[model samples]
Target chain A: MSVVPDSSTDASGVGADPRTGPAPGPSRAARLATRGIPLLVLLVLLASAPLFAAPFTANTLSRILIFALFAVSLDLLVGITGLPSLGHAAYFGVGAYTAGLVSIHWTSAAPVPVLLAAAVGALAAVATGWLAVRSGGVYFLMLTLAIGELVHQLAQSLSSVTGGSNGLFGIPSVRIGGEPLTLAGYVYWYVLAVAVLGFLGLWLVARSPFGATLRGIRDNEPRMRSLGYSPFRYKYLAFVVAGGFAGLAGGLFAALVRIVNPSDAGFTTSALILLAVVLGGAGTLWGPVLGAAVVVLVRDTFGPQLDGHGPLLLGVVFVVAVYVLPRGFAGLAGLVPGRRRSTGGTA
Target chain B: MAGWFDANLVSILNGFAIGSLLFILAVGLSIVFGMMDVLNLAHGAFFLVGSYLAVSFVAGVSWGGFLAALAVAALFGLLAGGVLSGMTEPLARRPILDQALLTLGISLIVAEVLSIIYGNNVRSVPGPPGLDGSVQVAGSTYPTYRLMLIAVGLLLALVVWLVVERTSIGALVRASVADREMVSAMGIDNRKVKFAVLGIGSMLAAVAGVLGAPVYGARPGLDKTILILALVVVVIGGLGSVRGALIGALVIGQVESLGRALLPELASFILFGTLALVLIIRPRGLFAGKVAHS
Candidate 1:
């Protein structure tokens, strides 16, 4: 019923799929060192990216990181918990709009708006989750899709707050230490720092015992229920956490792009995030980061040249990915020798 | 009070027109999902294709052009459905997510390609020549095209009922929906049945697309919007039953148009609230079909 055993062991202590447990015949320290090396190299590369890349490239990379964060959060529900939410972008939009509103009306203290956005996202999840968690499988998928469209329609219709279809513009950049972050390079770093922190926090949650129970529920909800674990409670919690994280990503997105349109909360964005997660391999924590990078870079590179054909190219990518790389980028990456088990649970 | 009565009458007529469109579009989706277990996200793309084809084939106010478009769209739908079914055959036993993603990929491709060809603009095709002008009904002037749509919708619903409930092919489809393995055990050639079900479903969607062109128009975002509405109808009506789809579509259609007219601010709220209520009260839908799978 599942694609692969959600190999969850990770150096960062990200939760591994409980069904598979830890890999045999390998020292934990050995696993840590092997995984840590690549992660360290990647982080260092990201930290120094602006020094080498063009300003536009740096800015684009920042946007990629934001999307990557969104995808990673979604992976928690879809990959680890087996919830196929088609409307995950609702929370992302909630965060973006919240941050945008704050920036427009009051403060641009960077962290404050993002934190508020996360809180708002969590609250929205709680409200929606109350009803959404009642069903499973296809029903859940449809419900999420409905809620997403509802939010999108609201965003479009509520022109005063969302600026309707035109979206809210002129969002001020983050100001740190009472100084405005005017430089393009500083903005990139600010986004990177927040995204990295967001990802790390998710990693910690996935590593916890709570994450393990969620995996158990995904594998067999009935079995878990018999064992006296409330799958509903766990699923609800996962939904809220994922929503909060997605909101953080959205706030960062608004800050990075300086705009939040109704489309940000639409099904298209939700589908794109799902595509990235599936492309990266749902179960792996870091795979979606790679997936986000690929999707964003492909669109950025081809969007201008192709004009209207960008979506066509993306469609082609989705079809090819499904047939050729069902296990996704993380699955392909796993084929490389000497890698430790990574975080991610199967559906 | 008389003005309010006229408004109510108009809303009711409008509801029927929208409901019938929903019925035609969603019935196919319901059957395919129930019998084939393949949730073709690309179903909406077929609707878009039908609309676009109608625009090209339709000469101003000509029934011949509309018929031609319908025939071509059905042929296209059959070919597309068959190809997709073949591709999806291997993944039948795989996870639903994999299947959904694959189909979603197909939808994305079709939608993008269409946009590229047609551009991202709303293009309309006029209704048949006979139904071009307004007709007076109950002291209110209404579009003749809309009334025609209502008539055709009711006729199609009747035809669908007769075909599904009274025909031999219907028997096979019902049996297959009940138990695929059992039908195959009875030597019914489940593969052919499956293909037929998918093909017919696709054809129905395209037909509705052609018929609905005048009312909804053809556009870039139409696919997603129609897909969502169809999904809502299917969910509300029940998964596998034909009667369920009819009732579900009509209710949603009425609620959407009437609700929008009655309370603009709370229109979406009321519409979505209905879905939420259905999920809470009867997760299987108002007319829960027999094809209930875990």
Candidate 2:
């Protein structure tokens, strides 16, 4: 909690001078003001989106919420923990499969499937992370990719359970108090409520001591180890937490689409989610949500017009973003308030 | 017993052919990452283009046009390498993730453009005319084209090994791989060596792509599949080791073929299983190479 403000100020590059304020307390309050105002306005806008948005736009926003939550979970590993997992969609897929299976076999009851999906996702993460976290850097990336591929293969081969290549369809609608969420507005509200809770939960974790320890691990694993902290343990716990949230997002996706396929677990999906996190300014939790919106909008707006060339537009967006907006939307936010002397510095 | 022997022999031959293709793909990736510290995910795009170009040449002209396709692909590789260098050198101080994302974007663009031009259907290319007939071996008839693949693989292995281990350029590359700053401090132009290696590596991938189209077909997303498989080969064989890639490719090729024969439903899992086991047993890979830890 204590480190969050300092890191934010460092990232912003505005509060570099120590003599900017009369006291430390005032500086902290100022930091919160600069960040919090934008967050509040964004929250209000997201919450009220269904009021004025069209049905298609509302549905797109709902899809964005699911992907945003997933991307944020990936950010926990990539940005905060310095573990860039390419197999993140494995857990997401597991959650989606669990939820889809539940709706098909056991019940259409919403909470039960979501909770079960979370549990399955966390367990899968632990199982995979145990071996994966043992290696660092490129090896870690490779291991995660292999594990993700294995899961994808499983999804395809387990035909009876997963419905094979065609995927599990006709998943019952998520019901709230015996009422199905049929309309786009209703689905949006439901997804928004879930997303809010999910975001707040993750925000609390990010602002906690655990989050600070993760940042420390990311910056210097050896130093953390020298200070008597087990880096492996922290990484494992973080992976589990990230996987849990990814699973929740997966459940939302399954409900949103009413189907789950092996493609959901594919490496391309994982890459896109990672791209979203990077585009959003990795460490900032909320930035990924905005990143997801940009990616989804890019895909949606040009996808039909370009047909098969949609990924080409996205590729252009990625390359341009890397060169032009290196710090992503969060960095852009810092520039808007003119806190930093120059926006050219590395984030 | 004779029947079993014939089947096993054929499987082994097929695996080597597949493995030979993988070696060409993986070596480029391994060398680029090992020497330059850049994981060029776009390496796959080079291969994708080669495959598509080969398909076009073979269909429009003749099988003899395969060589022309390879030449064009190599030229394209050089141009692409120059473009990549231009894009990446400006951001030389950026993190590996940023560089990787940039390369990935290039790859995605290539793949999409190819799909747009070729229209996403899987297209196969026939081998050159002379390599069409089947050869009888161990009581089984096998495509002579596959044997030619093995021969190509062996020749490439020998050529690469001789060049890397026996040539002046190879020594420079080795020295650069061991200590880049030290090599540069000695007044050696390491940047040129890096570019040369990148260009050569990309060319190798293109050649593999031309050869691979006959067996695997040219298709959208072929880049992603081949990229993952090649990465796995590099990891299992140990990064930057030419010999390791050869051995690793052979092993994966066998696993893929045998798994397809035995457990068709679990062919991909067999490869993943090997990867997991190898990583657990030797995190640096089965044959640790000159590449440094990240």
Model 2 DockQ, alpha carbons vs. true complex: 0.49
> What's the iRMSD of model 1?
4.1
TM-score of the A chain in model 2: 0.87
State in Å the error of residue A309, model 2. 2.4
Worst 10 residues of 1 chain B by lDDT: B285-294
Q: Candidate 1, TM-score vs. the true structure?
A: 0.95
Give one digit per residue, the lDDT tens place, for model 2 in A1-347: 24354544342322222223233334656867887799789889988888999989899999999999999888888877778888899999999999988988888675777778878999999888887887767777767877787788789888988988899898999888888889898888888888778887777666667887777677667888999999989989999999999998888888888999997988777878887987887777777888988888877787889874778887888899889887788778773233221111111
Instruction: Compose the digit string of candidate 1's lDDT tens values, residues B1-294.
Output: 877768788787888899999998898998888787788888898999999988889734688898899899989888888888888887776677777778788888888888878888889888878887889999888889889888888898899889888999888777777777888899877678778888888888888888889888899979888888898898888777788899999999999888988987677678888888887888888876566364
Q: lDDT scores for all predictions? A: 0.83, 0.80
Model 2 misplaced stretches (Cα beyond 4 Å): A1-44, A335-347, B1-5, B59-61, B290-294
DockQ of each: 0.56, 0.49
Highest DockQ, which number?
1
Docking class of 1: medium
User: Which CAPRI category fits model 2?
Assistant: medium
